[model samples]
Target: MDKSYDPFKYSSDSLEDVAEQISDVLKCPITIEDVNHRLLAYSTHSDSTDPARISTIIGRRVPEKVIHSLWKDGTIPALLKSQEPIHVKNIKEVGLGNRVAISIWKNNEVLGFIWAQEINKSLTSNELDLLKKAANAVQNKLLYLQKGKMKKEEREQEFFWKLLTGNTLRHDDMADGFYQLNKTMPPIYSVVLFRFTKPITEKMEKQLNYLLETTQLVHICLVTIDYNELILLVSPKEEQPLNQIKQFLRVMEKQMMQRYNIEHFAMSIGGIYSDISSVHIAYKEALAVLKVKERYLSDAEHLMSFSELGIYQYLDVLAEKRKHNRSPNYPLSQLEKYDNEHHSNLIETLETFIDSDSNVKTAAKQLNVHVNTLNYRLKRIQEITGLDLKNVNEKFSILLEIKIRNMGL
Candidate 1:
């Protein structure tokens, strides 16, 4: 070890530069790797390198064989449990020479590892002390990087929140914000709203983050609206946007249920919009779908999409209009009056008929009534509403009226 070498003097240097300085001071080759075994940096000196180190450096990942060997020898477990530097002699069985390694820690969290290889001779106590100092330097570097990353993510999350809530509307400003975050605004985007039956746990949040990071979608932005609601904005990397969105939702739903043990949840997806500035339009649609699911489709278990809302979507629109005294022209009120007077389910029967694809037998089975009884009720509904069941326009009008009535419009 160089007695006069000050590890602090190289504080401003890059990880690779720090590794080089450490290698020179310790008289051995050095490598820095993240917790996932991804190579971060390595010394240039390679006089006595092994195939494993060379391959790891070239691939930027430690190979599975080396990882398995390290695990089998209990080196990985020891490294993870220890804050002090560890010396491994005769690593030749694992296709490597003697080496010293230490886990980089910040606040007791293992961030990465520093490895010093002993090529020509064994590392002495002084060299081990120098390696430990290098580990501390790596720890500081990781801390700085982690803090920088967290700050960047915070800014991005804030931007996403504002954009989704309609606070930031200008196209140029939105684009600039994305640029600052080093993210590209996708040409087409959609929003998905998730509602949990219970408050989210820290483990659930970590799982959500992992899911988002591993998903195939491009340009994803996830933000928690509250303890029970989460919003995701994403663009499909594939060509079939709608299909891809559905597939993604299905996978997420299954994973949440099976992996996280979440039994009850709902996911609502919005229509895709082509312009980035219109993301709030999608956001609003997603919220509407969630509201519609909770109020109208309570039996719907996991997934709902804006496109699947059908007449209910128009009902929501009509609802807004009705609030302003522009009520929709539907004659379901006459049926409602008749049903209330007769204590009948005429409106439900009509809805079941439509929902069953106009199949009388299927509608009868769904309503748990005989075919003749369902036929008689349909005839009564037609007579009361003056709608012909055989007429397409009349059937559609009845369906729309039923939807409006269901929405209490």
Candidate 2:
């Protein structure tokens, strides 16, 4: 080991220099890579480099084939689990010679890797010890970088949360915050809210974060508002913003289902609003859409948009009006009262009947009841409400009334 080697002296600016120093002390070329195998830094010595290392540097990532080969040989897994340097005697089949690799770690988490190619001779114990010191230096550098990044993300998330929650009012303030985050104030943005049946797991959250980072959208911000919900704000770069969002959401749904086995989830997208200050409007619209989905479109698995909500978009307005004004009691409320008094489910029967498009046989089949029993129930409903089932207008009005009541308005 080099008595003068000091891991504490390196900073972000000196990462490449540290790699060069390690290379000089160990008499081997060095390559530094993130856990994903993306190249971070490498020594300048090129004379003794192998084809794999050269390809990794050129491509900025380790080739998939090389990674697969390493996985098959259990080398990648071993390095991931251990902080000690691992020596590969030979990997000529994958266009590499002998090399020693150490996991750059912090708090038991493997952050990256530092690899030293053993070109002319195997690394001695002393050289391996020096490599460990280099790995510790890289770990410290990564920790510093990660902390800085986390602070920036925290600030951005706070700004985004404030924007969504309508805490920040002035456009200039928002613009300044966006500028601090290195983001522009989007002219128009839409919010998408995800609701999960269960709280998201750490693995699920990590996968979602990775997906958000890798998504092809040009401008986006994702934040978790609750344990079971995630909010995504997107500013589309294309002419058709709605279409772009829908397509991105579809891809996300498929990946979530296929990759993560996430079966019970729903997503609602709000209408696009032009001004940053009006983003809360979009957020409310998204919440409304989610409510509509839960009440009316519970069976739908794809993303629901505010524009597609039809008459239900105005339900929230009606609900508020109903709150302040004394409106006529909904006719469906009469049936609900009767059902509760009698311990019956005439409301469910009526809903199933309407949902089946007024087909008595279909409704009966859906309800798992005999058609005559369904007819008797329909007759009783008409008798109780004095509404004629044969009249189209009456049926339509009843259906609308039932929908509004189902929304708990």
On lDDT, the candidate that comes out on top is 2
For each candidate, the alpha-carbon lDDT, in order, equals 0.77, 0.78
Q: Write the per-residue lDDT of candidate 1 for residues 1-409, one digit (tens) a residue.
A: 4776666465646998888888888888889987657788998866568877898888786765676567557777688789888877655655776788899888756778988887878878777777777787788788777688679878878998888878999989998988888887777779988888888787577567645654543446545556888788888864888888888888777656654566677788898887888778888898888887887764333437888877766776766766787554545777888989999999899889987889999999999999999999989987887887888888887777666656566
Error of 1 at 125 (Å): 21
The lDDT, on a scale of 0 to 1, for candidate 1 is 0.77
Locate the minimum summed-lDDT window of 10 residues in model 2: 294-303
- Supply candidate 1's per-residue lDDT for 295: 77
Q: Residues 1-409, candidate 2, lDDT per residue (tens digit)? A: 4677664355345778878888887888999887667777899866667889888888887775677577667787798678889987677788977888999988867778998988778988878888888887788777777688679878877888888899999989988888888886787789988899989887677668645654555356646556898788888864888888887788778767755578778888898877888878899999988887787665333438988876676766766776787665566768988999999999789879876889999999999999999999999998888878888888877776666677667
Give the candidate number with the greatest TM-score: 1
The worst-scoring run of ten residues by lDDT in candidate 1 lies at 210-219
TM-scores for all predictions: 0.62, 0.59
Candidate 1: the clashing residue pairs are none
